[model samples]
Target: MEVNIRHARAGVTIAVDGLAELRELEWHDGHVRIGAGLNLTEIERRLDGRIPLMAEWFPQFASRLIRNSATLGGNIGTASPIGDSPPTLLALDASLILASREGEREVALADFFRGYRQTELRDGELIRAVKIPLPLAPITGFYKYAKRRFDDISSVAVGIALELESDNVRRIRIGLGGVAATPIRALKAEEALAGKPWTKRNVREAARVMGQEGTPLSDHRASADYRAAMLEQALLKFFFEKSEVVRG
Candidate 1:
């Protein structure tokens, strides 16, 4: 059943279907409060055309309708290895707000998921909202690849954030989705880019390392080789795209 709470000062809180609970909501800066019940469609539209921080990294998410009802908590709470949000959120260093019925609180983001479809959230504790620090945006983009570009789930997704410092990568962050049991951070790829001169060779080497980081499996949608190649191409394209933006 849907739970609704009427606040004296704040607006009503409606329990979102298919989620844990309607804990709370708040928005500040570029960050928004998301009750577990707040559906994806709502968040996507609200976030639409705004979260360009990882645009060059991975742009293709669910459609408007899908986004409308899909809860933000569902994406993180589902913890699906192939789910779209984790990798980008991981790359962006988002923080999860956990709440207990007793009013206790906890924060987790990095190193939260233990395995596929698993998370660190304690039982009966609900996700209040996630906090994302807005991007500084020197060279940032999201690149996602799949069999069908529009509606199909990704075979591999890359989220790369870079800061160009004097023709070299001063800083970089990479997040990979659908390449492993959980959306993953490509620390190796980031390391390869940092302090290294931006060039085709460096990008290729980083792509190689990223491929190694993936444990892509043969599935109905894709073969292991295709996933690896997709990651390689995605990373390469992201490098060039960001290079252009940062150079400009």
Candidate 2:
């Protein structure tokens, strides 16, 4: 519930944790709504079994101290290209609710980011909550490659969501981060894998397409080539690790 002071010249910094509306978390019949003010640790605890993918990736996030302080809303508000949560949220087809004095509006997480640290949030609008549709027997995976195993931003991060229908990929979504100006859905890669038989060959081909989905850049964390390679390998790794679940 603590907010950081980022502006050295700022005259005043007001605390909004007392705002009741922003601190509420609600569970519905077919979906869950998470308030913007809830910290990562709180969210993971509440959504543990209901949203297993979050638990799968939560350990790879920052240290416990940071998780206690960092809010999910703050992470999305920054709209950073390498944010760990955005890609996973996008893969789940999440929608963000933005509220203002005028009214509340919903935007798909896939369409949320406009550019590096940019989003569709307009003046006077603030993120109220994030809503995700429930998936029946979903198989999800998240992978992050960073300088350190923990507390470091990813050089490449991938999130995959799959619903299988008897060894065939009935539906699939792929999300990638740190390889472009914004976190992005690998639509072409998803298209390549959808409706295809769940096999190593099919996944490998789809991964090749995934490597072409983003325009990667060379940076201190990794070279452009390395990032792209990791992107492809991440897909393969996820599929292989979940092969039993995928086949079932």
Candidate 3:
């Protein structure tokens, strides 16, 4: 589509769907390696609910038509700040397997994006697969705020993976999109919540830090203030939802 719309130019385009090696999916060394060639639909079916965060993310990404054709490699390759996959993958502490003539190397998703529409991929390197570490977090949530509930781009997207110990936060990872030049982890917020009691006050403080984590810009989709508000609300919402689940 970028080529058709003249947004991207390529002297030649090579089809890679026929590369069987790039379609292999397997679990090894305590991590699941998902082939870069697998489309979102195929990924969802293959993963089932093993990865709870991604299980909740798939349905909210674009539409069925888009999911059927969009591959994980392509999504990560684009390096779009608003791309849905990055945030979720970041929350899961995923990494990319970059392959080239020389050999293959893994790059953490957090370090993959260098800037807006830029990545660490070398000239000859291609993403072969995505590796997600095993033993998923106990509490996970994905929140995408857009003008439309379905089939719309997000103005703010939050992916969270958290572990709680005796009502205190053992660990937490927050991935955010549409609020910076690249998808980023809310490190400061995580620091604020770490080892703190999972109470309204601690969460509220961390929420404030999260809202200020990224450098948001006002765009047609939403105002910068609105994006910040959503970030704050997303964390609070997740906490409330999980609290309700525990109460039940």
Candidate 4:
């Protein structure tokens, strides 16, 4: 109250400590239902091996101290364009469950964000849990570029989820952050790669398309051109990594 009053702002703050539904972290069938209130450390520890993409990405969050107190739900609720988890979740085809006194509703993670820091969440409603479907694509990758490797925010980030049949791209989803008003799927890039041979040439072409999906801006962390270049390189890096895995 003192802080708010001194800062010339409303001092109201609601504590949702009693919301039991927002604390659940459980596996249903093959997928996992992660409560919004669950801290990052807990989410990281439990998701190891179970959801490899999440395991890899969670460590890239701020710092250990921040992770201890930061909640997965809080991150999603903030809806920052550069949020680490959103791109990864978008690639994984995740969904969020929202609850209100009326009932509960499911919203696709990709469709959850309406604009900068805005979401489909309604008044009097809260995020219940996040649903991560099981058996992620055989080839999954995440990459982010930041001024500082660890605690800093990303200048650009990419997440790739690809299912291959022989040497051809069976299915693919690419998620990008820090390049648009909201985290978005590079659907045009995905279309360029899908059903085509997973080759350097195809990957390169799709990467070109990837660079065109979002409207990036120049900021302190990086310039717009640099971010666009990184977007292309990120997808190519993931492609090469998957190729190495297949060869090995």
Q: State every prediction's TM-score relative to the real structure.
A: 0.81, 0.94, 0.96, 0.93
State how far residue 75 of model 1 sits from its true place (Å). 1.3
Candidate 1, residues 1-248: lDDT per residue as tens digits?
02354433436655546544553455677665556666655554456646665343223666666666666677778777777777777767677777777784646566778787778878877777777765454566677677777566877777766667788888777778888888888887788788998888998998888777768899987889988888788788876766657568
Q: Model 4, 10: alpha-carbon shift in Å?
A: 4.8
For model 3 the TM-score comes to 0.96
Worst 10 residues of 1 by lDDT: 1-10
The ten-residue window of minimal lDDT in model 2 covers 1-10
Query: Compared with the true structure, what per-residue lDDT tens digits does model 2 show for residues 129-178?
Result: 88888753389998999999799889988888888887889999888889
Stretches of candidate 3 off by over 4 Å are 4-7, 245-248
Task: Write one digit per residue (lDDT tens) for candidate 3, span 26-145.
Answer: 977789999999989998998888899999999999999999998999988999999899999999999999999999999999999999999999999999999999877878999999
Number of colliding residue pairs in model 2: 0
RMSD after CA superposition, every candidate: 7.1, 2.4, 1.3, 2.6
Model 3 steric clash pairs: none
User: Model 3 misses residue 199 by how many Å?
Assistant: 1.2
lDDT of 4 by residue, 1-248 (tens): 23565575546788663477777889877788999888888878776767777777877888999998888788888889998888988898999999999999999999999998899999999888899887678778889899987898999888888888888889888888999999899999999998999899999998898888899999998999998999999988887777877555
Model 1, runs deviating above 4 Å: 1-36, 54-59, 104-108
- lDDT of model 1 at position 200: 88
Candidate 3, residue 12: Cα displacement in angstroms equals: 0.5
- Distance from true position, residue 236, model 2, in Å? 0.5
Model-by-model lDDT, in order?
0.71, 0.86, 0.92, 0.86
How does residue 242 of candidate 2 score in lDDT?
Answer: 96
